[model samples]
Target chain A: MTIKAINVRNQLRGRIVEILTGPVLSEVDIETAGGIVTSVITTRSVTELNLQVGTEVLALIKATEVSIAKI
Target chain B: MTIKAINVRNQLRGRIVEILTGPVLSEVDIETAGGIVTSVITTRSVTELNLQVGTEVLALIKATEVSIAKI
Candidate 1:
């Protein structure tokens, strides 16, 4: 998916530090240059991404209300 | 901070699930309606937010290249 924003605030990079799997949700921890970021992705996404500890990923965050635009 | 975008794809609301403190950086876990969202903020932000395990916060993410736009 492509995400374009007129105002982008935060985009941080980190690695998967840990992954905690639960019956309903899975917690993915990412260790970045600055710190560690955690994401609760579906067990499906986890399987799709094949995310494991030490995988490099990016965490994109915007400190505003987000709307979708079709390009 | 105000985050605005022409295209916003994902915005999830979650509660603070956990916080891991280190010497320089801190890990923040937010439990949302769908899942958990993790953010790596500075120790300063952690202190400023006064984030605990149960703090409710919004985890805003956009799957795109983000730029800053000033209004």
Candidate 2:
């Protein structure tokens, strides 16, 4: 399925640098221009997306899920 | 309560530029060095945090909740 658009406001494009797979979830790290953006997705998604080291991907973050902290 | 630390991997420090409040949620626009990071958090959090224009904050995103998209 082709995703033409997504509601997620933050989209950081980069290449996969590492993958730490677990029983149910996997941590996929992407190296973007800003920095390394890490994403922990379901193991199923890792397999379904055929994600691997060097694969280009976008780290998507929903605005609703974002938390604000005073600093 | 003071939070010493959080598990969220991504944290962007910025100053609140705008805020659109609603009944339940609010869209907070923050200006950071990278760019403008927008967040839609609960209005209750807005009140509790005393968020307003020019408020300095960190936009936090958990790795577990970040989605990966191939590009």
Candidate 3:
């Protein structure tokens, strides 16, 4: 598979429903227009970006590196 | 699948081969005693942990969440 500049492989269109930034990993909760499709956790998110609730963002993914779950 | 205290699931025993820390994320380079089986990218690893070269580590993985390929 082709590796992007960063590990972020594909741009997944989603809206930020919740963002829980703690002492460690930043959990950016996203909800796609389709349904409760996926949840992503990345170490890269920081408070300085000002990524607030109800923000529109892309859940960049590596198709080869993605895992799907149903809840 | 059981979720560990963290996203880290099953421990795929490996050794800390290398580590690259940048402003954004920490890239942990691990090599299994077996061979180049897998590589993991977690936002949780830090320099303070002193996860150094030849250090023993567990490349925890989620059974249901694992994807495999060759290099």
Q: Which candidate is the best by TM-score?
A: 2
What are the chain B TM-scores of all models?
0.68, 0.87, 0.60
Which run of 10 residues does model 3 chain B get worst, by summed lDDT? B36-45
What is the number of residue pairs that collide in model 2? 0
Candidate 2: tens digits of C-alpha lDDT, residues A1-71? 78788878888788999999999999999887657778999999999999999999988888887889998
Give the per-residue lDDT digits (tens) of candidate 3, residues A18-61. 66564555657678865543343444554555677777777666
For DockQ, candidate 2 versus 3, the one ahead is 2
Pull out the clashing pairs in model 1.
A8-B67, A38-B38, A40-B36, A67-B8, B14-B31, B14-B32, B15-B31
Model 2's interface RMSD: 1.7
- In the range B1-37, model 1's lDDT, one tens digit per residue, is 4545435455667788899975446789888777777
Please, what are the lDDT tens digits per residue for candidate 1 over residues A1-71?
Answer: 77566365777788888887755457777888878876666678888888888888887766663455544
Docking tier of model 3: it is incorrect
* Candidate 3 lDDT tens digits, B1-71: 65335544466688877777544346777788667544534344455566777888777665667678999
Give candidate 3 regions above 4 Å deviation.
Answer: A1-71, B1-9, B37-44, B68-71
On TM-score, the stronger of 1 and 2 is: 2
All candidates' lDDT scores? 0.72, 0.88, 0.61
DockQ of 2: 0.69
- Residue B63 shift from truth in candidate 3, angstroms: 1.1
Q: Report the C-alpha displacement of residue B31, candidate 3, in angstroms.
A: 1.7
What are the RMSD figures for all models against the true structure?
12.9, 1.9, 9.7
